[model samples]
Target: MLVALALLGVVCLALGGFSVRLLLEQRRQAALIAQQATQGAALELRLKELGKRLESYQRINVRMGEELGELRKQVANLPERLARLEQRDPASLSFSQAARLAGMGASAADLTQACGLSQAEADLVARLHRGRPQD
Candidate 1:
């Protein structure tokens, strides 16, 4: 009977040790799971922040595209305006007509303003007129 009691005590002690070990392992597993949950929450927050920034950039790009389109339209009209202005003849009016329109008696400044000619162009026109022999 003494031997049987000693064997029973040893079995009980082994079971107690195993139970303590299992409890410690369960606590360790719970700590690991909590850490993983925190890490997942942080990753989710970062992803949300990245998504917001991407949306803001997309809006800015759209606004810039609209501005660029308007600029292109304005640029397209420039060539037509330039072409029309180039078609005008600056020397169509005779010196007498230019003098009359300028309200001066054939003066160089008056002719320049009347015919929309620069000073150099008016001087050239005057020289050409003088070179012509009077009929």
Candidate 2:
């Protein structure tokens, strides 16, 4: 009976040591899990912030695209507008024709109205080329 009791005591001591070692290992694993969880949470928050920034950039890109399209339309019509301006230019009139009209008794007002000359230009032509009567 005494030997059997000693063997049981030795077995209990062995089990107690194994339990303590197991508890220590569980504590280490739990600490590692907690650290990993904290990192995961931080990463999730960073991902959300990055997503918002990406959305803001996308909105800006869309607005820039719209402005680029408007600029393209203006550029497309530029040649036509320039051609119309060239057609309306009054500088195409020659000075000799204005002088000849003034010598034919045309008034300064007539020169301006009929020959595309400016008022000052018509007046100068009239002064230089007014008809002279034969003596």
Candidate 3:
């Protein structure tokens, strides 16, 4: 009876040790799980920030594309606009030049020679601008 009782006490001690080991392992696993949860939250926040940055970059890319397209359209129209300017009336150009020369206090003969204006047109411009102060 004494041996049996001693054996029973030894078995109880072993079981108590095993239970303590199991409890320690459980605590360790819980700590690891908590750490993983924290890491996951941080990763999710970072992902959201990256997503916002990507969206901003995409918007900027779209705006730049639109601006580039507008510039291309303007560039394409340049030749036609230049053609119109080249085709403007010779008389109109002469008249404009005559008016500018007359405004500078040029004589009628000077207007006629320099701006290809008719004598009558040169006289008219000279008369019209005679009152303005000279630069």
Candidate 4:
């Protein structure tokens, strides 16, 4: 009976040691799990913020694309608009006026100042369009 009691005490001591080790391990594992959960939550928040920023960038890019398309359309119409403006400009009629004045015996200086012709342009028109001298 004394031997049996000693054996039982040894077994109980072993089991107590094992239970303490298991409890400490469980606590350590729980702490690690809690740390991992915190990290995961932080990462999730960062990802959501990045997604929102990406959406904002996409919206800005779309607006810029629309503005670029409008600019392209305006650029495309510039040449035709310039042509119309040139047609309506009074300077376009200067050469015809110079020639008519030349034909009516106007002097080179008169065409140059009156019709905005350069000296060379006035002299050429005077020579080309002047009337013949009366015989």
Candidate 5:
């Protein structure tokens, strides 16, 4: 009976030692799980902030695209607007140059060649500026 009691004591000690080691390992694992959860929560928050920033950037890009579209429309109309302005001023650069040449006694043909004036415009310049008639 005393021998049996001694063997039982040895087994009990072995089990106690194993249980202590297991408890310590479980505690370590619990601490690691807690740290990882904290990191995950922080990463989630950062991801949400980045998503908000992305949304703001998208809004800004949308506004810029709208403005660019308006600018494109204005640019497309620029040529027609410029044509109307030039039509309003018949005495443009060529006409002025033709008139100066006519005042300097240049013939209608000379005004046409030197100033790129149309034949009718050259004749008008000659008549208005008292230039000599074509021979």
Candidate 6:
């Protein structure tokens, strides 16, 4: 009977040790799982932030493309207007008439002052005024 009790006590001690070891292992595994979950949440937040920034950049790109198209249309119309203005005759008028037809304003004095022209130069401009004359 004494030997049997001693054997039973040894078996109980072995089981208690095994249970403690298993409990520690379970706790370690749980801690590792929690850490992984935290990391995953952080990664998800970062991904969302990146997605928002990408959307903003895409919107800006689209707006810029629209503006560029408008600029291209305006550029395309320029040559036609220039061609019409270029076809007018310059030498057929008196100096004052020539200046008026050339889109120089009604005030010849003001035009001369603004252009820093001598009287002779102003008279020459009136005499040989051309449409869209070069600076």
Best by TM-score: 5
lDDT, candidate 1, 1-135, per-residue tens = 999999999999999999999999999999999999999999999999999999999999999999999989976765464344335563664544543443333556766776776675565445444434443
Q: Model 2, 65: alpha-carbon shift in Å?
A: 0.9
Model 4 TM-score, all chains together: 0.57
How much lDDT does candidate 1 score?
0.69
Better of 2 and 5 by TM-score: 5
**Shift in Å, residue 16, candidate 5:** 0.6
Q: Compose the digit string of candidate 3's lDDT tens values, residues 1-135.
A: 999999999999999999999999999999999999999999999999999999999999999999999989866765464345335776554655665677788999998789776687667668766667654
lDDT winner, 1 or 6: 1
Q: lDDT for each of the candidates?
A: 0.69, 0.79, 0.79, 0.79, 0.78, 0.65
TM values, all candidates: 0.57, 0.58, 0.58, 0.57, 0.62, 0.55
Alpha-carbon RMSD, candidate 5:
13.7
lDDT of 5 by residue, 91-126 (tens): 654665565678779888998888776787677667
Q: lDDT winner between 1 and 3, please give it.
A: 3
Give lDDT tens digits, candidate 2, residues 16-133: 9999999999999999999999999999999999999999999999999999999899667654643453356538865566667878898999988888878876776676668843
Candidate 1: stretches off by over 4 Å: 89-135
Rank by lDDT (best first) = 2, 4, 3, 5, 1, 6
Provide the lowest-lDDT 10-residue window in model 5: 77-86
Better of 2 and 6 by TM-score: 2
For model 6, residues 21-94, the per-residue Cα lDDT tens digits are 99999999999999999999999999999999999999999999999999889767654543443354334323
Report per-prediction Cα RMSD to one decimal.
14.6, 16.6, 12.9, 15.5, 13.7, 10.1
